[model samples]
Target chain A: MKRRTFLKLATATTMSTLAAPYVHAQEKKFAGITLRFGGWGGLYDETIQKYVAAPLEERTGLKVQITAGTQSADLVKLVANKENPPFDVYQADSAYMVEALKADLIQEVTEAEVPNIKRILPGFREYGEYGVPYSVFTYIPIYNSELVEQPLTTYTDLTRPDLEGRVALPAATFDTWSLYLLALAEENGGSISNMEPAYSLLEQAKSNILALAQSTVAMIQMFETKEASAGVISDARGHELRTKGHPIVSVYPPQGIYGATSYMNVVKNAKHPEAAFAFLDQMLSDEGMLGLPRALRLGVTTDVKLPDEIAKDLTFNTPERIALKKKVDWQKWMADRSARIERINKILRG
Target chain B: MRYDFTDYVLIVAGAVTRVAVYALLALPAALVVVLSFTSGETMDFPPAGFSMQWYQKAFESEPFMSALWTSTYVAVIVAIAALVIGFAAAFAINRFDFPGKGLLQALAFSPLIVPAVVLGIGLLYLFAWMNLIQTMFPLFAGHLVLAIPYVVRTVLASLTLHNRVLEEAAMNLRASPLRVVRRITLPLILPGLLSAAIFAFVTSFGNVTVSVFLTYGGNVTLPVQLFTYLDHSYNPLVAAVSSIMIFVTLAVILTIERLIGAETLS
Candidate 1:
């Protein structure tokens, strides 16, 4: 090459390298745009703001307005204002997603809009093309390590003589009772279509039930106080009790664990679609995916590497682990919810 | 010196009942406050260690502080509005006969009988269809509906107990009705008003159901915030937030006591 040509190329390259930051600033075209997000509060919201929203704001000059609200109420807000959504993105759990879809309250986006959609575990994308799971919770059997002599392998084991009058389970009134019912059903050769087997199994287990706790807090307290020798609870909650110096042990049942998930979806009539999609891409990114796992021991949906200690305390931490995690058929469950709740109430409350 | 056996038994039972009532009323709250200082992750009873980290987090948290502020201002506004409207309605009902007086009385106390769930959804759908939920009016109105009944009841009771002769004397001396009300009636009902304000304040502040349906993103009251938090999961921070809430209530009571004598509050 001629010296003149080499000099020209070097000078131009240096100038462009110097102007790269300026070019990046220009690419931040969404500077004035604000994306509204409806999400969980407490540690969950705090973690999202810290890990996903803040960095995205700095990188793209777009602001995220995160509004904390009850999940069901939030869906009501969207349904009430279906023509003009108040939020651009929202965190929708299973029941909310079903109802939102029925009401046509959310938009569907493909991998073209959000590249990270490809990274979301296929099982966690059970909400179809509308949303992807950001974090997952597991329903696992637990027992008082110091009180119970035998290890529990299945929900059927709660009927064992050792667990009689020392077992506690969630009442039908509890929001997440379907998962527990499904576990019992799956273990007894029935599924969501026929939860009848689980009820009869529950009848045998009834003699053992010290109480059907009305809430998760009640369930935890029963375990904490050793009032319950063996039962089922959220994996994170069990691990939390263990972390807090309780004698609780999480048991892996033979059929595996039940999956309860929280998802991030774009609102149907979002004012800022590109910005909302960008925010979603970051949520599925490695940094954002690990926030819940780090904060609350929730399993990450994407294949983000977690510290071994954190992974050990969580469920669905890998594709293999997720493969074992069964997502509930929320539609069928929701449809039969009233009848099931009534029957379970009679069985458990009795 | 010479007490009857029946008298002694009655006295012993009375003493026992008083202690039992105090233990039932106060011990649970005291234990919760004690658990709030827990250094451990869970807010279990009889905490293992002590730490102010939760309180520190509560004060530092933007969402918590914002929600606290929202609850405070919302309660303050609702209480003030309920106080004015309640005092007027109670005075009018107490002072004069009107058409549909019985119906008006029933209407004032109607909210107490109607379930809060019904009211919440009623108000939510009422203003929600108009898209007025973007403003704070829906929450304010809902709280007002829930709070007005308490105020009206308290003020009506106060007005009934008020001496009518003083107002008559003031009027006979050529004092205007407004002046008589300002001078004689209000001073007499001061205690009732004070107590009623506290009722309204606490009612709006601690409300969850109606507020839950009405609250938007930034306007959530403290109770709804805590409710949603617990709905998702429970953490020690809840205890801390609750402790702060108790402290705020106590502080408000103390401030009122200082401003108006405790006897008046009682």
Candidate 2:
């Protein structure tokens, strides 16, 4: 009907098609750059490699090399290689993030560099610029519903006479042990600084505990073997146990659930800053935030809503649940961790 | 054939003790092998069902495969190096009376007494100071230190047990010292050398504490990988990996026994 309009629309379509690849090519500008990332091993590393690293490399043409280690070991490497950092991007738990920030091992990020940062839940974004929140999990009481008769509402329930010789406590060396201690302190009318009440209560509950588990895996084993009926464990692990048909359920206590967050930071003297930023930005994206939950049953830090099935297991997704997460002064707690651990150990022994 | 009450009791007690010892040694390994074949996702005793899916998963995992290769490569190198150095040291200590020989002997076995964690940290610091912490050199060096002690101990025991008469006779017959050692001393100790080599290989292959500190970049050993994996999850995949390791180690020992004879190990 109109020859001029037809030619104009065809040309516009052609121009837009040509411009699309150009824009895509511009996004893949970090080609030839190799980004070295340091993080935890096992399922976490595998998940990130599959869902985050591989996809990021395919989209951006940037190669990613992952190095996995324990939290302390990774921190040691970062500190050792400070002048010329070994990792372009490093993953750290919330507690170690404070140490990394204090030592100036990692750098700050703005929304300009990581646009998806804005999508993170408001509560989990308190690390400021030093670290980006990747996942959130709560250390709460997990019990074998078959063995436990009364509903477990709080940490104090662990001391109940019925749970005698059936409760498992995390060892002093584990990170969650600190969270458990903090929760116990809050429940027993002692703050993080003054954990005397917590120690006394734990001492009183000592006769009830079966063992001080070396790790969350050990705690899970205890539950599986029926060696212990109840123990403090991460919500993710509880979900894993439940999924495995282990009759385990995680209870968010009335006092408050101790929340722990894992974070990713860009090393200060990064070899390839742009590539690191790009990888980090991808980590915070809708796709990136979904990987943790999908791969490891971990709680996502993003405000991105998950399917109802997964959301039901996660502890701190909703506004109300997030409000129930107890906030600890990690800096102060980490400072007194050794003394607190020693005190707790003494109580357990006695 | 008639026995008193005390003699019969002793016989029964001895039989029970032997059975208990065997069970203690064999049950855990059997349990691991059994669990590796479980169809269920979790690691449980009296496994839910029998399937080889975990073995396939173990083989397909990139990290596990890489770690297996790294451990094998390092263990092979460590075994060779430890054997050479240990043979020479054992020969020297056994043949000659040198100054500070006792000190050298003590130093060689020092690794056995020092906690692995201590040695690991010390090695980490030493490697960092030398600017070699990022490379696989630390891992190689640390494992060599650990492996050397077993080699030295086994070789020394062999040297002590065997008579030096043949070696002396070879030396007296105008054969050079090197020739004497090659012709007489070496053959006499070949069995011990083989045993020591196996010990060194196994020790290096299964090391965890030192390797944990020395592992850098992507150079983790299998044991370190397994340990790290256990921290994250307790699936039958670990059992599968352990079973593979046991099978490989058993195959190696069997192959060596066939080539060298089981009497040599004894």
Candidate 3:
């Protein structure tokens, strides 16, 4: 009886030892893939690299080469050169994705390549297929609490004479033009469908704006200097500033807000498209989305639970706010009126 | 009336006014330097605080340091290469009467008139065709093209202004042509050569628009790095880096002065 018991124990130990390598191999597979990705301005890249790239590389054998210099002009230039592309994947905000898709600069990716698509909030998934929603960036108005006794919460309040010269708007030729059009449409009780009134309203607002900035970070810095009393800025950046102890309050204006989402789209002809998609799928998983707000230091996804402080500042999850958020027909804006936009910009500068 | 104290005072006042106007004219450059030093992460006229942290940050970053080192070597090489090639070309143009002299001069100066962006694009396409993409050699070739015009123009100017008959006199004294060139002709043109070298180096160092499209993932120039950094975020780090660049520039000027005195050799 004792001999039989000893043999059985030895066999169980052998079985356990044999399974260990299989488990080890599985863990190692996750870490072995390298992803080459590109994006617009590099702030998010820096944040994502620190939070996502490094950890993901260590945890899964997946390494990532994060490229961040792919601005609008670079995108256009890269797309124009069809035979060879410099990047394996790129991040395009909602508007540019349309341009990229239309240009055939990128290929359409289905849910199969991105299994975590199921985990994404319904609204975000339904919005577009060009990219996986990484962060919902928008121009949120921030006001100095010390100067303004009553809180300012809407875009229309910017026209108040008291706030006239103190207002800062993004001077980005594309974003500013779009925002002006949207605000004008909102003010005139019209939908984002029409841009004629948008143009007229933009002209009116052009008169009141004290200065225009190439970046929202610049606008925030201007606000911090007490040079400007109020400005429109990205929600993520606004939250970052407020955390640094600036007496700034972000308001998602009552008329509605516009959202510019950065999405992760695999390069059309990536060298390792399969491995790249696998890593991307991990990025979209429940665990992945949860990690975003903390790792990215931005607003969290609506469906995913985030820290209370982050949730308060983020607009992704709010049902009412999401309903009011409008999409820009960037193609129409780019095609029909880019020249007109340039003319208006010149007039404003003049 | 006869020279009075009031008239002298008025003349001094007028001189002071002119100096002020020049100062005002210099103000824009002064502002760029000051803004380059302003100590805030993001750019604002008056800094929230002052710190050399950005300089420290810039040097700490691997890419910026590598880019700086790359540009320094590239500029030095380009200046020397351009000077040698330009001097030969300039001498051939000035010393001999050749057919198509005007056309050659125009061709040599052509790169200067070409917009840097167009030149950059042309070079990009040409280099890609030659399978030189993502290589420092292309940058060297492109920068050499940029530097040639400056060097040629300077050397040509010196040839025009200096006394060429002195070299002829040396030759008449039984000095060999090589000896005459070494002792008389070269000395007369040394200042122009030095000026051209400095201009070449400056042109290579400050270039961004041309370098941007050319730089791939692994290779980058200083101005290209700075452009990327500024584009992403406006931070005092950029100012800090700019300030350090200004100091380095001053140091370079001083070193050059110590080697070749401020007075023109001619």
Best by DockQ: 2
Error of 2 at A331 (Å): 1.0
Cα lDDT tens digits, model 2, B203-230, are: 9999888888888778778898888888
User: Across residues B30-120, which tens digit of lDDT does each residue of candidate 1 receive?
Assistant: 8878988999887766796999998998899788889999999988999999999999989888989989888988999999999997888
C-alpha RMSD in Å of predicted model 2 compared with the true structure: 2.8
DockQ of structure 1:
0.50
- The superposed Cα distance between candidate 2 and the true structure at residue B175, in angstroms, equals 1.2
User: For candidate 1, what is the lDDT?
Assistant: 0.83
lDDT digits (tens) for residues A1-350 of candidate 1: 99999999999999999999889877686799988888666677788898898888888888888777777778877777777777889787776678878988788978999999899776678877887678878777888868987777776777787677998877775456547788888888999999888999887677888987777788887877778888878888888788778888777764777757788888888899889889889989998887778888888887777899898787665556666777677888778878888997788667
Stronger candidate by DockQ (2 vs 3): 2
Interface RMSD for candidates 1 onward, in order: 2.0, 1.6, 3.9
- List ranges where model 2 is wrong by over 4 Å: A1-25, B1-11
Better of 2 and 3 by lDDT: 2
Predictions' DockQ, in order: 0.50, 0.55, 0.27
Give TM per candidate: 0.93, 0.94, 0.82
Residue-by-residue lDDT tens digits, candidate 2, A228-324: 8998888888888888898997888877889788988888989888888888888888788888888777888887879887777788767888889
TM-score of chain A of each: 0.91, 0.92, 0.83
Q: Is candidate 1 or candidate 2 better by DockQ?
A: 2
Question: What tier of docking accuracy does candidate 2 attain?
Answer: medium
Q: What is the clash count of model 2?
A: 0
